[model samples]
Target: MTTAPSHPTDPTMNAIGQAVAEAREGDVAAARRKLLSLWSGIGVTGDPLHRCTLAHHLADLYEDPAQALAWDIRALDAAGAVTDQRVQQHHAALHIAGFFPSLHLNLADDFRRLGSFEAAAEHLNAAEESAPALPRDGYGALLRTAIRQVAEAVAQRDTAKRDTAPGRTA
Candidate 1:
């Protein structure tokens, strides 16, 4: 039942927000530059929260699906390392359970985009399994809808591939 922090003013959060805004504006390269600068400060073994957030945003910057998948994997790894103390200190609920859904969903999207339907299905399943950890609010609902859409798309693509393969007819 943890609520979002009343004050979301951390430097890392601010940087992430700015980068996300830049990406949303279609300036992904600029967003990548901003995130890379922050990533350097965070380093490989930096705070898990910072690493996860940075890597997740960094993934969106890449035009290459494989590169984005790599970053999403890093984000999922860092999310697993996030500590409860860090979550409390940040006044946010970033436990692995809460983080996994989005991480897996993003990974699923990346895999689907790369035409790796099996990998995409695996991650989509993981996302669905971890979804209850998310806050039961508008954001969570939106995420759930997104997950479903991605799952449906993957299913359709897989079926289409199967039907079009040799010796198969639609």
Candidate 2:
């Protein structure tokens, strides 16, 4: 059996830790902004794993799910470029972010707005089917509750929108 090599502790990871701390304290926007700058300074360079991880982090910030998906694709490609077996494991473990159900739901909302009910339903079904793993703790419960509430709200809004549209059939 082959084991993945551990990532070396590095400046970039250190910066990411600091940024995450800030984000946990409700400073995500600011943390992400600083991260963007710091990341840019790293510049035109990094190992494949590093580049893939950075791309994934940036993609998480998008309010527009469609754009997020685009970034995810880039990240996936970068991850795949790594030749090391250990690196490949690292990359494979993270593939779900590109197809996360929550993100799909957001994209579904956008599709709904564009009057694409079929597409929206497809996204909604996908989101419902994808069982994204959650943390197992009080914090996880809180987050799950919040996410469910948001999903309910989105469902309600979609129903309302459909009802209000002319010639829409129940």
Candidate 3:
């Protein structure tokens, strides 16, 4: 999902952030291991915000489209259960609405990489429809641009992963 400043008071979120940071630093396996451990403890019915954030970041650690799709799906499912209050509790600037575009964009990208154009288009459309919820800032612009690029890829039936796709180190 959209990366918001971490709320240090929440250990789960803090751990998730650290794992994400590790993945970003090119140690994806370690990050994935750390996150999986956290996920095991969180369980399926754990805090929605924690599930959403963790799954979203965890998805980025996978190079395989199908694997990423699974975690992205979990992230989207958890996002559905997340409340604005919960999101704002983590970062005052965050809103549950603002999470949808990135969530859908990631799903669409994964589906596209898997050569599921129809499904990709469906989620790409959802991302575009939710675009207005994003702030008029860098993150908003990035997701909007990614949506357009994914739409084009879907039209061309291109299954090759984009260089920019989160095919993080394994």
Best by TM-score: 3
Q: Model 3: which residue pairs collide?
A: none
TM-score each candidate. Answer: 0.80, 0.45, 0.97
Judged by whole-model lDDT over C-alpha atoms, candidate 1 comes out at 0.74
What is the TM-score ranking, best to worst?
Answer: 3, 1, 2
Runs in model 1 lying further than 4 Å from the true structure: 1-10, 158-170
Residue by residue across 131-156, what tens digits does model 1's lDDT show? 99987888688678878888887987
Local distance difference test, per candidate? 0.74, 0.50, 0.89
Q: Give the TM-score of candidate 1.
A: 0.80
Q: What lDDT score goes with residue 45 in model 3?
A: 98
Q: Which ten residues in a row have the lowest lDDT in candidate 3?
A: 161-170
Put down candidate 2 lDDT per residue, 1-170, tens digits, no spaces.
01123345456655655665666566757766876776687554555555555555555555454655554555555655655553445534433333344344444544555555676667666555653543355533543453454355455554233221111111
Candidate 3 residue lDDT tens string, 47-110: 9999999999898888888989999999999999999898999999888998999999999999
Task: Give the Å shift of residue 153 in candidate 1.
Answer: 1.2
Lowest summed lDDT over 10 consecutive residues: which window, candidate 2? 161-170
